[model samples]
Target: MLALPTLSSNGITLKPLTLSNATDLAEACQDGELWKINETSVPEPDKVMDYINTAASMPDRQAFVVIDDLTGKAIGSTSFHDILPFVKRLEIGYTWYAKSYWRTHVNTTCKLMLLTYIFETLEYQTVGWRTNIGNHRSQQAIERLGAKKDGVIRGNRVCRNGVISDTVMYSLIKSEWLPVKLELTKKLNDAH
Candidate 1:
């Protein structure tokens, strides 16, 4: 069992998913339009509590509501799922943000914090991402993070709206993390 660390970076913090987060998560899920770039569609507020509870119960899945300590509000959500500890790999997905945080440093900072943990702390060899092929913004974002394009898996995934779609695979191996992390940090700092 991997113990999750209390992670914080640049005023952004990640708290483990819990029943206490239901309302804030439900409210964040109200930004349904953000699903355009998010492969998983946001659930209705009425369903968020159950959805979050279910996530909290999953042994291999851990979700976090991205919070900004400045205003003490949840700005978005991200998760580490598809954990394969024996193989030392985990897929980072199910990420989205409120409109106010988009195009800001929040996303990168969140990724930086999470990747730092996954690669450095956990000593995990690989971190992977799968994005809907049609989601160009997500594809670009993953690329900008310096993940290597491993090629597309045609018709590899299904969307929330019940549409079958291809997935573009990207990954960062442990050996490649240093340069990428340096580049990502520079980009994030330049933006600040």
Candidate 2:
């Protein structure tokens, strides 16, 4: 199993996801608007803990709470999932954030930290992302991070809403990691 290190950088931190974060996480999910795009959307506030627990139970998943360092509050969740040990590949996904945090440096900073750990510390060959075909927002975000689109897998995934969707895949290979890391770092620094 890939170890998940607690990551902190540029006013954002990622710590192991626990049931204790349910309250804040639940609050973040209140908009329910984001539900449509989430791969595993919690239908109601009460389902948040169950969702967290289910994520916790996955052997291949290392879930984490995306914390806002300024407030010390849970603002979102992201993880390293769908890892292939022998193949030396993993995904940075199962990620969702509060409505208020969208379009902010939060995601950029978080990705910088996660990618740093995945490509630097773990020295993984590839970090991948899979989003619903209709999820243009997510696709754009991954692209902005310099992950190349590897095309879509038609009807390969089922969303929480029971919709069968095409999975649009993207990845950052080892050779691309360093340049992308520098670019992301510069972007994050420029934000301040």
The model with the greatest TM-score is 2
Q: Which lDDT value does model 2 have at 84?
A: 91
Candidate 2 structure quality by residue, lDDT tens digits, 1-192: 766779898888999999999998888777555654556544357788888989888999989899998988888899899999788899989788888888899889899888888877887899999988887888888999999999989989887778788989999899998899899989987888
Estimated TM-score for each candidate: 0.91, 0.94
| Top lDDT model | 2
* Per-residue lDDT of 93 in model 2: 90
| CA lDDT, candidate 2, residue 72 | 86
Give residue 143's error in model 1 in angstroms.
0.7
Candidate 1, poorest ten consecutive residues by summed lDDT: 32-41
